[model samples]
Target: ISLIKKEIETFISSYNKSLQQKDKNIKISDIKIQKNTLSLNINSQGIFRPHNALLQLKNSISKEFGKKHKLGVREIKINNYDIQFDLEKKPLKNVTIPFADVKFKEKQATISLNNIDEEFLQKNYIDRMINLVNEKVENQYYEGKGEFWKLIWESGEKKPIWTKDPTEEMTKLDWLKQGPTKGKWFFRPQATAILKTMEKIAVEEVLKPLRFQEIIESNLVPFDIWLKTGHLEGMPGEFYYISEPATRDVEKWERFVDLIKITKEVPLEELEKNISTPAAGICYAQCPVIYWSFKGKTISEKSLPVLVYDNTAVSGRYESGGRHGIERVDEFHR
Candidate 1:
């Protein structure tokens, strides 16, 4: 312990001499040693570059001591970057951030970023990660043959249905009309008839033959359900979300009604203010709720293969730019 203390003192004295030459305003004072730990107060009159200076000092100590010591700071100040954090507790301690400059406050932190090579980060990290993900997706999901997907098994076969072209009359039928937003369409009778026929064939011929029972799922599912089903993470920004009114109080509704009566339209700001955080999302895939239905229920081995399918209620998606004819509409039934 005495040797350690003497070594720390010697390093501190050397470091202080360097600081004296370069930054006379910054000084370490009130150095105390207790149980293999050295505590020192840094006084720089708020003008010192806290993060860089502290990191440098810590690195220097590590280099000198060779992992015999570690640096733990109580607080630090940072600049040049905006960082926000929410803490439910006070008197934060033992905070550690690697390769970052940080200023610590009660509930927030500010960070100063060091110069980085953007091209290197893009090429080495981002692009490499994307390429790895694409490789996995192509190898497993797209290229692999599935038991249920007939297209993969029959890809080499030259079927008459595959060569059929749309009739000129069918092409000119104007079977689809644009809806209120992009990626939405109104199907005309001709289109609806074809869709209904397809649905009938799918249910009557394909599903019913396989003893698959029909199940109708709700159009709006809670966000919690989506989270559990992995859709919230997997399909981010792909589904349409919905929220309840901010207040359920009768007085609030009455006030809203009065304002609506006066304006003959919902006040935009008020409307926005009244909408709460997303409580639910419009069903993107009909099967998420179906999986959720089986939660917490133990199915016997006798009920081993439970098959069900949904063919009602249009699922909603926010197709940013990939909208085409009746085939790829945002509001679609499956």
Candidate 2:
């Protein structure tokens, strides 16, 4: 028993060190061998899932303790660690107080009303309610799309025209509908020719005349880039995240391919459990990646303003609602 405990402790220390090196916020809080099972209690930071971490650890354990060993991982328990919030900032305070007997579990806190003034609290509470109402009204007004159009154009003050007429000529444009998703579509020869013509006109007549130099850029932007640009902070759920496969584990890839071939169905939940953490976010806009090119460099006076464009840039965005047509799609070329 002593020898087993020593070996376990050494393995745990090495595993914890590896996790630290990888900057993962997970560690085995406790481990015990009962009968033939090896139970591990994982303590992770707030909201951090240990799926990938545990997967790697399991692989490590399998290699360390041979495949024939009787050790099996049945449960993975996560205990929440206390998070400290700044009280001086006067964060959102809940007004409702339960009348029933409140039983505090692992963590306990005491709220004292003795020093707080009743009249002052009431006044602030009313003020908070008013502010909340004002905020909601403002949000609704801004978020709600209003009828607006650009009437004035370069060719004098001409108004845009639209029609919903059902004609054979117009209906023929809808030749392709074999897109994998609702917002994506496959353009047939007819539609493709028209699209190519429009692209040529837009480039030759509009962009080329303006001396816009086209440049090709990657569709994937590192997660850290978005953080530095403050876009992720503004719209946390707007962009699709990209994850890489466990390329080092060749057997895992083979197993996945075999599973797909046999089942003819994707095991998304299983894949999610085993896949690595997202390394980058899909390009939400072309401009963000363009800025990345100028990183770690100084601009001279001669290069006052950089003029560049990317016709081949494909952007992806996760829209929560208000999707009408192909104009607003999950993936689009700008």
Candidate 3:
């Protein structure tokens, strides 16, 4: 880690010197190394310029590390950046009117609003909503001259326009350089927006009716209790520990695990089953979960169906592969 940090710092110095030649006012404030991943905090005079610099830095780091390390921009703070243009807030065009095609048998025919099919209503509503969203997103983030959104690839090519379904040509084209993989899915802004929009649609149109609620919870959970509950079945006992340094002290590690197990009263067999290694035992001190939920028993049939949504960070271990990217990482938000 120290050696990697030094290499990163040296690269940053050279990168900054190059930027000076180009009259670019961007510099790395700090470089944080976490295992094999690098997080860089940057300061720049413009918003987009910092992103460009980050991409360059990532590419440089990837070349330096030779595919063993992953790099990410932890944060970018623009010193004097300002939004110079406004998104034209125009009314939606081609709005679809629900039930507009309904035919009346007679001049005085009437229909109840409730009589509309739920499936039809939902489909139409979501279609119209998605259309409006797409229009807004396109207008604000269109890729062309005089557009509000401007993104350049690491290869100095203009990014293609955002599409509902990116074509083979578009997908093959290079756009961003912030991930282990280099393809359409690695374009952070577009990919993140697409995922978020899909999740929103699922929650609002699909899962919402199924009694699932969007929830906000911490990713960290009691490790022993987590194990006792049989949450990490089948998978190996691999975890990212928050209090890892304390585990080096034998007494503290034992006391920590003992305290959690005693508090939760986890069965001895279950504890043994979960904590297979010293690392796993120490990781039980601070385990990360994507999400969790529990409901109290109620004797009413109305409460028979209980649903929950857990969205949080999860950690896992994986062997190295060329296909690995943001999708498959040691720590990721589900």
Highest TM-score model number? 2
lDDT-based ranking: 1, 2, 3
Give each model's clash number: 0, 0, 0
Clashing pairs in 2: none
The TM-score obtained by model 2 is 0.53
Q: Can you write out model 1's per-residue Cα lDDT over 1-334, one digit (the tens) per residue?
A: 3457877888888887787677787787677778755656565533453334555676687677765654433323322323333333342342334444545476444433454333323334433333333343334443446556354453565658644333323447777667667776666799778879988999899999999998888889898998888888677899888888888887767767788899898877777776798889888888888889999999999997999988775799887776666666788876
Clashing pairs in 1: none
Off by over 4 Å in 3: 1-187, 231-233, 244-301, 312-332
Tens-digit lDDT string for candidate 2 (62-138):
57765545443444343332222122222222322221111222232222222222243334443343344334334
The local distance difference test score of each candidate is 0.65, 0.61, 0.48
Alpha-carbon TM-score of each model against the true structure: 0.52, 0.53, 0.30
Clash pairs of candidate 3? Answer: none
Candidate 1 regions with alpha-carbon error over 4 angstroms: 1-152, 155-174, 248-266
lDDT string, candidate 3, 1-334, tens digits: 5656777778778887787677566666666667755556556554334545655665676576665665444433322321122223433232232333222222221121222332443344534433444454444445355736666755766777864434333344443344353311345575567667877787788887887765555545555545665645433445444332423556535755786667866555534543434333222222233223343434477775546565543334432444344444443444
Better of 1 and 2 by TM-score: 2
lDDT of 2 at 309: 82
